[model samples]
Target: MHTDRVYVVTGGTRGIGAAIAQGLRDDGARVCVLARQPDPAEGVAVDLADPSSVPAAFERVLDRWGRIDGLVNNAGISKVGPSLDYDLADFARILDVNVTSLFACSQAAAKAMAAQGGGSIVSIASMTSFTGQPERAAYIASKHAVLGLTRALANDWGPHGIRVNAVSPGYIRTDLTTDLIARGVLDVDAIEGRMPLRRFGQPSDVVGAVKFLLSAEAGYTTGQALVVDGGWTVNGYFK
Candidate 1:
C-alpha cells in the first residue's frame, strides 16, 4: 500500500532514522532523508534547529513528489547532566531540535496530507518518554513532550485522515551506546539482564514499528505510543 508513496525522515543519515528510511524504501515508498548532513539523491539537508528550515525541507519533498504520504520525525539530540547543573542554553537547544522541530515538521506534513486527503506521521521517542533516566532531564522532558504532541496532533488532524503516533525505543544498540560501552560506562550484560528479552534492540527493530505505523495495516491506529523496548517498561522487578 506504501508503493510510490513519498515519506520524509529527519536525521536519517544514520542510526534508527536511517533504518526507518531504508525500510520505507524497501517497501516501495520514495524516502527522503532530511538532516544536517544528508546523503545525496534522496537526502535533503535541513537544520531542524532553525524553524525556517523545517517548512523549506518539506516543500522540497512536495515539489519533487507532489505529495507527502508519511513523515517520520526522527531527528533529536540528548544532553546528559544533573538538572541543576544543566545549561539553560543547552536545554533550549534540545527543546528546539527535539520538540519544536518535530511539531513544525508535523504541521507542514499535515497540511500536505490534508491536501492529498490523508497520510501518517510517526515519531521516534525514547524509553525515557515513560521512565526517567539520571542526568537526562532535558532529553526525557523533550521525549515526554513528544508523546503529548503526538496525541494533540492526532486529535486535530484525525478528521483529515491523518494518523499521528510515536514509537518509544528501548536501549537500541547504536553508535552512541557502542561509545558508552567502549568508555566502560555502559554495562551491556546488566542491561540485558533487566530486559525481558535479555538483549538490546537493533535499528531494524524500530524500523519495523515505524513502517507498520505508516502502512495501511495501522489505518485504525492513531494517538498511540507503541513501545518497542523488549518489555522494559512493564517489568518493575527484573528477573
Candidate 2:
C-alpha cells in the first residue's frame, strides 16, 4: 500500500484516537472513523463491546471505502478504584471495551488486510501495562491483554503480510489524565520526574510513533509494543 492509504480509527471522536486519526488524515489518507457520535469527518455509530456490531462496522468500511489499508484500535475504557471495592459491572465493562472489542476489531481488520495483500494494525495500549499502580486493576489488566492481542495477531497474520503492534503511552496530558492528576489520584509530578525528559507526554508527541509504525518504515516490525513514555519504562520509573 502507499503512504497515503486509507485508515479506520476506532474511538476517533476524541483524545489520542482523534489525534492519531488527524495525523493519518494530514498524511492524505482517507479515514473512516468509527465513533459513537457522528461528524463531518465521516464516522459511524458502533459500540465496541458488542460482537455482533463488529462485522457490520467493517462492512460499512468496505462499502464506503474500497479497502482498509490500516486500522488503529484506539477505543478503550478504564475504571480506577481499589480492587477490593471495585464495582463488578465497571470491571467487566472495562475489559469488554478495552480487551474484547480490540480483539474483535483486529480479527475483522486482519481478514480485510489478508485478502488485500497486506495491512497494519496499531493498538493503543497504556503505561500501566508493564507497571502496577494502585486502584487501576481493570485498566492494567485490559492493557496487558492488548499487548497479548497485538502479538497474537502479528504471529498469526505476519505470514500473510499483516503487521500488528501496539503503542503504550504514559502520563498523557489529556483531560482524563489531567483530571486524575488534579484530583490527586495520579501523581503527575512524580511520574514525570521519573522520566528522563521530566514532563508529561503530549498527544502530538505520540503521533510520530504511530505514523512510523503504520508506514513502510516499519515493514519488518511486528509483534512489538512501543512505549512512548520518555524513558519512564526503561528507568524502572524512579528518580
Candidate 3:
C-alpha cells in the first residue's frame, strides 16, 4: 500500500524505530532513517538534540527523495531517578530532545507536506502520556507534551491536509528495556503479571499500528493517541 512513497523515521538505527522503518520498507515505501549514527545506505546522520540539525536533516530528505510522504518522530531519551533528586540538566535535556526536537521535525515535515497538499506524521508517545509512573517525571511530562503537540498540530495544519497523530506504547521489550530489566530498574515478571496480556510487547507489536496511521486507510484519523499496550493501561483489577 505504500508503494513508491517516501517516509522518514527518526532514531531508526535500532529498537522500535528500526522496526517501524523496516515495516514501512517491507510495504514498499522509500525509508530514510535519521539518527546520531546512521547507516550510510539508508540513514541520515542528525543530532536531534541539536535544534539547528533538525531542519537540515529534513532538507536533506527533501533534496534526496524530492518529497516526504510521512515522518515518524521516534527519537526520545529519558533519565531515571527520584523526582526530588533528579538532575535539572537531565530533565531539560529530555524535554529538548523529546519535545522540542519533535516539534521542529514536525514543523519541517508539515511545511513540505503542506506544499504538496497532504502528508501524515506519527510520533512515538508513551503510556506515560496518560498516566504517571514513579521516577519518570520528566519522561512523562515530555510525552504529555507530545500528545498535546499532536492535537495542536492537527488542528492548525488540518486545512493544509497534514494529519498528526501519536502512538503510545507500554513496556515494549527493546534493547533499552532489556538493560533496564537486567539492571533491576524494572521488574519484568511483575510487569507481565500485571498486564492483561501477560507478556511484554515486542517492538514488532507496534509496527502494524504505526503503518496504519501512516497509510491512506487512516486518512480520516488525526490528533488521536492510539495505545498499543496489550491492554496494560486499561486493566484496573490486580492480577
Candidate 4:
C-alpha cells in the first residue's frame, strides 16, 4: 500500500527502529534507515546526537529518493540513573538526540512533504511521555518534549497537509530491555503482572500503530499520541 513512498526512519539499525523500517519495507515503502552506524544498502550513517549533521543526513534521503513521503523519528538514547547522579552531559546528549534531532528531522521532512503536497510523520515517544518512571528523568523529559513537538508541528504544518503524530510504546521486549531482564535489572513477571494484557509488548506491536498513522487510512489523524502499551498508563493502583 505504501509502494514507492520514501520514508526516513532514524535509528533504524536495530530494535524498534529496525522493526518499523522492516515493516514499512515489507509493505512496499522505500525505507531509509538513518543511524550512527547505518547499513549502506539501507541509508546514510549520521549521529543524531550531533544536531549539526541532521539536515545533511535528511538531505541525503532527499537526494536518493527525490522526495520524502513520510518520516519516523524513531532514533533515541536513554540513560538510567537517579536524578541526583544524572550526568549533565548525558542529559544534554539525550535531549539532543531524542528531542532536538526529532524536531530537526521532522522539520526537514515536513518541508519536503509540504512541497510535495502532503506527508505523514510518526515519532517514537514512550509510555514515559505521559507518566514518570524511576531514574529516567532525561528520557521522560525528552519524550514529553517529543509529544509537545508533535502537537506543535501538527498545528504549525496542518495547513500544508502534514500530519504529525507519535507512538508511545510501553516496556517492549527489545534488545536493551532483554539484556536488562537477563541481568535481573528488570522483573519480567512483575511487569507483566501490572499490565492488563498480562504480557510485555513486542516491537512489532508498535509498528502497526506507526504504519497506520503514516498511511492514508489515518488521513484525518494528527497531533495524536497513540499508546501501544498493554494498559500500563491506564492502570491505577487501589488505595
Predicted structure with the largest lDDT when compared to the true one: 3
- What TM-score, over all chains together, does every model reach? 0.97, 0.94, 0.96, 0.97
- Per-residue error for 219 in candidate 2, Å, reads 0.2
Q: Write the per-residue lDDT of candidate 2 for residues 1-239, one digit (tens) a residue.
A: 33559888999988898898888888888888987774844876788867568889888888888899999999998766889999999998899889888888888888989999999999999877888888899989999999988888899999999999999998788887888887997887777778899898999977788888999999999999999988887885344
- lDDT for model 4, please: 0.92
- Model 4 shows how many backbone clashes? 0
lDDT (tens digit, per residue) of candidate 1 on 85-204: 999999999999999999999999999999989999999898889998899988999999999999999999999999999999999988988999989999998898999998999998
lDDT of 1 at 178: 93
Worst 10 residues of 2 by lDDT: 36-45
Quickly count the clashes in candidate 3.
0
lDDT string for model 4 (101-163, tens) is 888899889989999999999999988899898999999999999999999999999999999
Q: Model 3: clashing residue pairs?
A: none
Against the unseen true structure, what C-alpha lDDT does each candidate score?
A: 0.91, 0.86, 0.93, 0.92
Where is model 1 more than 4 Å wrong at Cα?
Answer: none
Error of 3 at 224 (Å): 0.3
* Clash count in backbone of candidate 1: 0
| TM-score: model 2 vs. ground truth | 0.94
What is the C-alpha lDDT profile of model 3 across 1-239, one tens digit per residue? Answer: 99999999999989999999999999999999999999888978899878678998888889888999999999999988999999999998899899999999999999999999999999999988989889989999999999999999999999999999999999998998999899998998888988989899998888988999998899999999999897888988785
Model 3: lDDT equals 0.93
True lDDT of residue 205, candidate 3: 80
The TM-score obtained by model 3 is: 0.96
